[model samples]
Target: MKNLKLAAAIAAAVSCGPALAQTEIVWWHAHGGQLGETVNSIAEQFNASQSEIVLTPVFKGGYEDTLTATIAAFRAGEQPNIVQVFDAGAATIIGAQGAVIPAEDLMTQAGVEFDANNYISGVRYFYADSEGKMVGMPFNSSTPILYYNIAALEKAGVEPPKTWEEFESIAPAIVDAGYIPLAQSHSPWIWTENFHSRHNLPFASNNNGFDGSDGTKILVNNDAIKMHFSKVKEWLDKGWYAYYGAGWGDNQTPFENSEVAMWLGSSGSFGGLLNSVDFEFSATYLPYWEAITSEPTQTFIGGAALFALTGHSDEENKATAEFFKFLSSTDVQKFWHKETGYVPITTAAYEAAKAEGYYDEKPQAEIGIKQLSLPSGDNSKGYRMGFYVQIRDVMNREYGRIFAGETDVESAFNVIEEEGNKLLDRFSKTN
Candidate 1:
């Protein structure tokens, strides 16, 4: 009787092991806070909808930190199946060559029905090569937008600025009314995107670093860029802008507390603002310079895309593809957009949301869609260059020097261009 009971217990334990051993696929990403919750919820939904594969979402800090961790993992031969890299890291990922499997091929091999045409052109172009092959799958795409506290604006007796000139014109008045006209966090990287997009100027040669490893140029010294910086400096001189220090997390607090009347930040920021702001708020298209011949150009995507890391088994790769398809589904995409305030990557998803009156009910959400839908010239698609994340740091440093009156505008631009080009040259040769 003792021998029989031992055999039965062994059998029961063995049976439970297989049930618990689901095929787990690891996903490393740079999303935290509310965005992180959205990612986990999507993974949970996908897991519930299917039993063949399980996705594990891992939080890997901010963009730069995530990239560093991914590189280290790859070097140590323990990379995740999928990694989310931001736009600034696009060139670096593409330049990594054999380290990554093109997202398009992975999806194709998985036998998933994916139509490349279904994605928005602006969003797709950034992740694709010259031959129109996608290197990564678009995820959590966002464009810059203007977020304003309605009560603050009303108290200051100012409307939302429609043009760059208008924004500058009202800065002094806002200051006089005891409101910060603009609240800037010490992040110069965000300013780079806003400045380049507003002027519709190219940040680098060869399709903003997308064309190839050979094309690289810095446009910091361009007349339009200089003008924009001058305007920022002017605002600073008039005490219309307040520096929020180096912590970006605390940067948005001024706007949330209705201390600042206006803010230029990612459209994804809407979710946080919605939760934190007690006063009425409105979002509008990012303001552009009235002097530019063409105003309101398409803004570049700021968020991350999902890349397939090499070394996954065939079955795992196929599962990843299937998961990508599941994410692209109209219902899932619409749900993500509504929940996270990210722009829907697929046209079908956008149309579905429109049909459901999602945009009508939340009018502020339309600002992102409108910004992306703007006419795209070569200048408007998005930036794709190596060492871009580093270049952004350089920009921040130089801009800070200028704002602190450490250097004149021309001198600052000259130094930034020279230093930036050196990094670009080195990245080009190494990649």
Candidate 2:
């Protein structure tokens, strides 16, 4: 009788083996630090809420590093099921025809009622086809805003600038008061975004890549941008600004530490800034160049989106789609936005949070939502181009040259246009 019992137990164990194994989905991403923790927490929550799947969140370094690693992995047939690509990498992923599965189609096939109307127009437009089919899921979306140390400003007896002219005027006074007037990173990508937005200029032709196949190249040499860079150089010379090295996360430290009075950084920096600062801080809309226009245009959103990979079976794809739907639900989006300082992707999530007084309790958090909701013109929606990551590197190099006094503004811009255009051409052709 004991031998018969042992045989029955073995048979039961064998029968339950496959049922006990959960479907593991790997998510490759560029998030780290607090944002990384948030990603893991979301994955944990999802895993606990379901029995069929488990998501593993893996940090693959910064944005550029993550994209490079993903490409290498894909070539080796070892790519993860999902990867987070930033706005700049949108065109590259779209160009990878056989490599990606559109998220809209995936969700539909999974039997989830995925509705495009649920998402904000700006967020959806960035990741969708011309026909409004979503290519990826919007994750951590944000816009650039002016972060100010209110205490520092009060100490200097200067009000936060409401216009570009006022912003420039206060620079000298802040420095005279022995404070860093501006804490801009030495990285050019941030400046590129700032300059384009301030001047309300198109970074590239074809509505920054949403318009046409033959997109043209434009850079910082335009009159409005030239004037902006020249002003920055002047600030640098007057000791009004200090350059933090091109380290990915070091730039915001000065602002958080209250060493600098003002900074222009992503709205997503809200959480970290809030946690680290003891002094009073406030967020306002990004200042615009007074010469460019009278009003502020919508600033582009930064942060990453989740792209579904090709080559998975229909069942696997369906599972991935289910996960995407899970992510898009109003509950998940509100949780993500509230916890991570990322802007909500859906209008419903935004309105829901507002009704719950989420923004009233956290005033600084409202800046991003206000900035993204402003009317979008050609200049506002953000830039999308193949090889944008590489082009940004080139811009950074040229800006360093200018900062080092190796070249003047015009000369450096000339090099930027030349190098940047070459890269754009290469990516355009290959893509």
* Poorly placed runs, candidate 1 (over 4 Å): 1-23, 185-190
lDDT of 1 by residue, 162-205 (tens): 88788877877787777888876534445676457656788777
* Candidate 2: tens digits of C-alpha lDDT, residues 1-431: 64664465446545657766556788998989878888887886676566667678899998879988999999999899999998778888877878889988888878888788888866776777655588879898987788899877877789988777897788777877767988765345456765575456778776666553355575556777777777777777877777675664677888877778998787888887788889888888877776778776776677788999997777667778878888887888999999989999988899999999988888889888887777777676566677777777777777767767778888878887888788777877785
Task: Give the clashing pairs for model 1.
Answer: 209-384
- Candidate 2, residue 126: lDDT: 72
How many steric clashes between backbone atoms does each model show?
1, 0
TM-score of each: 0.90, 0.89
Q: Could you tell me the lDDT of residue 213 within candidate 2?
A: 34
lDDT of 1: 0.80
Sliding window of 10 residues with minimal summed lDDT for model 1: 5-14
TM-score winner: 1
Error of 1 at 409 (Å): 0.9
Model 2: runs farther than 4 Å from truth?
Answer: 1-23, 130-132, 211-215
Please give the range of 10 consecutive residues that has the lowest summed lDDT in model 2. Answer: 211-220
